[model samples]
Target: MPAFPNSCFQISVLLLGLAAGPGLLGCARVVSATTSAAAADCLVYVGTNVASEQENTIYLYRLQAATGTLTRLDAQPGGAAPTYLTMDAARRHLYAVSETQTFRGAASGGVSAFAVDKKTGHLTLLNQQPSGGGAPCYISLDRSEKNVLVANYVGGNVSLLPVQADGRLAPAASVHQHEGRGPHPNQTSPHAHCILPDPSNQFAFAVDLGTDNVYGYRLNAKEHQLAPAAAPAFTAAPGAGPRHLTFHPDGRYAYLINELNSTITALQYQDRQYEKGPAAFTELQTVSMLPAGFTGPNSCADVHVSPDGRFVYGSNRGHNSLAVFAINPGDGRLTLVQHVSTQGQTPRNFALDPSGQLLLVANQNSNNIFTYRVDQGTGKLTPTGHSVEVPSPMFLQVVSDFTR
Candidate 1:
């Protein structure tokens, strides 16, 4: 860690709004001490999409850990419609999906790689590869972080790319096309929404909005492949349109957010014989994401579990709110806790800081981002009174407890 200058210390104080508080008593030492100890700053990355290609960018913001105040740091031009992002476990590199229908004259989207600057928290483009599909919507690293997985909406396929040692990317090593459709008009064709590796890293799952199914894959990390598991597809309710799936910290249960029906289903995960036997998911309970009598058009976008595994959070686009649910430890059932407004429109994506103390939301239609304080005991959220104007903010990813 490097020593922060007096000016840097002063700016940090201003950003944190602690000019005359007990926390500032050590301001003099902040200039000479390590940056992390002095400011407790974290880095937040915002991905945006606009009509103009030049306006698509990945913006970096610094989060004051104590106050949850976000200060703009820098921005870099990302390729077309960089809507989703993920960082490696080492925090040395980041990957984003260019959500476009065509890349380099081919009928496929692109996955871009960037190196993370430790000191400035800036990103520099390393290389890009075809996502092996069109209109890629989500990108995530496998548990090993040695491979990148992508879900393409228009192409209805999932792709795997090998991560090079230098943080660059290689072309797709494998691509699996989904086959099916649903009852909804939006589900006329298969749409792969997101692919996430299980905590164990031995298995991965992809949720399809069009097919209303969650497909399982056996991760072949050494060979850089995603082989379909013995039981490949877990069917959801007709017209449910399952979009995103998140596993609990204990890995015994998984939650599926259905985009079309505005409901979340809790499922018990049973990996019988590891890689040899098929992974099974038995639906436990299904609950509505919207409040009673609020029968308006709404869609589900994202779902995440609390770091402590005590709560589940899901986003509703038309409802413009976050639905919080408490998890029953014994049976892995969900009980509705609260429905809090995101303070803006179209809550497309939200992320909890690494410390699990702050929740940041990106309101796409309103073009703003809002922060809320998390209550560890109650698993509820309260507005932090900190908001920033970001043009068409689509997704937010926080690198909590960041030094730079």
Candidate 2:
């Protein structure tokens, strides 16, 4: 392995209907990470919508890791427009962003905590809190599983909340409102699209789509808090609209995918800062999502670094394609490898299985989930020739061995 961030499960029979809204409830505790469950024996958890409407429910599915087969477990109704999702380290809880205009008695979007049943794939609502702003499109939990961080896109804010002992959630412990504008009229506003922590969990990075900036934060895991880093935010080109970012497993370099421009940036990491070394980078070699001369409009959504540290994948909306790239391990650079058809419309998000042998692409516009077989040795994706039809598939994540 060269260098990248070191980072660190599903179920579903019970459909816990929230009286007021969804609440988290508990089931199993992960007693051991050494369960001897093969990558092909893992469980998959997915977050989608209700009939492609505004948002009303999240469905749980069982994925046959070896075959890439999916079976719906049960559906739970809560929060509005759950555009994104993240799982706790222990696979005992789940977090989702409620991308609505209002939430938790506040005029902003919010987040929800749910208990996980590794065996049944069902989730019980634990708690809900305002994410400190509107349209909470993205959320994540620290590796310690002690804090939940949320990013409000339209509201232009980021907030942190405490996770309870039982996998429930507390109110906002800290909230930061971002300021500034980008170049384009549509992209020149503050829109915090994602909140993610580096693989080491030493720092956090938040990507803003509207302002063309990637904000970095210093984390206090023991204290359960977060603050802006000394070098606060990194600026991208005007109107780039950065959406999602990822780091190589070795932690030597990082990558960011710009939503507006449909470009990929390779960055070298040295001393916790992007340095001017062989790995140091500031601009993209090229944008890889579109077909030649077939542009209507383009927006990139998600970015992921392959487990083996040899490839990266990003999603394009209007272009409706998955851009693939090969990484030069010697110098943290990217070369456009291939562009694959998502076989559906508006692929809002995708996730790789823990074993890194499978990929799931959520097509939000066409209401379906597409699966692909991943070739670890060569960093390539081949269609599995199968799909699961669902309503407004927005976000996808894996819950390994949800059954303890």
Best by lDDT: 1
| Candidate 2 per-residue C-alpha lDDT over 1-404 given as tens digits, one digit per residue, 9 for 90 to 100 | 12223222011101111111113322222221223323543455566656356547787776666667777777777567776788765567888888887775679987888887756768888888788889888777776778888888888888888888998888888787888888877775799988876655666678888787777666666687777643434677788888877767787777888888778788765533332112223443445556567668878888887666788888888878888888888888787777888999988888776656678899988889988877666666788777898888787766554443
Candidate 2 Cα outliers beyond 4 Å, as residue runs = 1-38, 50-55, 230-232, 272-286
* Candidate 1 lDDT, 1-404, residue by residue in tens: 12111110000000011121353222122121112323334678898898666438999997765676888989889888898998875568989999998999999999999998866768899999999999999998886678999999999999999999898999999899998799999999999999988766766788999998888776777799887654454789999999988888777888999999999999988765333344358889999999999988999988988776899999999999999999999999999999999999998889886656678899999999999878777888999899999988988877643342
TM-score of each: 0.89, 0.85
In candidate 1 the C-alpha lDDT for residue 320 amounts to: 92
**RMSD each, Å:** 9.8, 7.9
Point out the worst 10-residue segment of candidate 2 by lDDT.
Answer: 9-18
lDDT of 2: 0.71
What overall lDDT goes with each candidate model?
0.81, 0.71
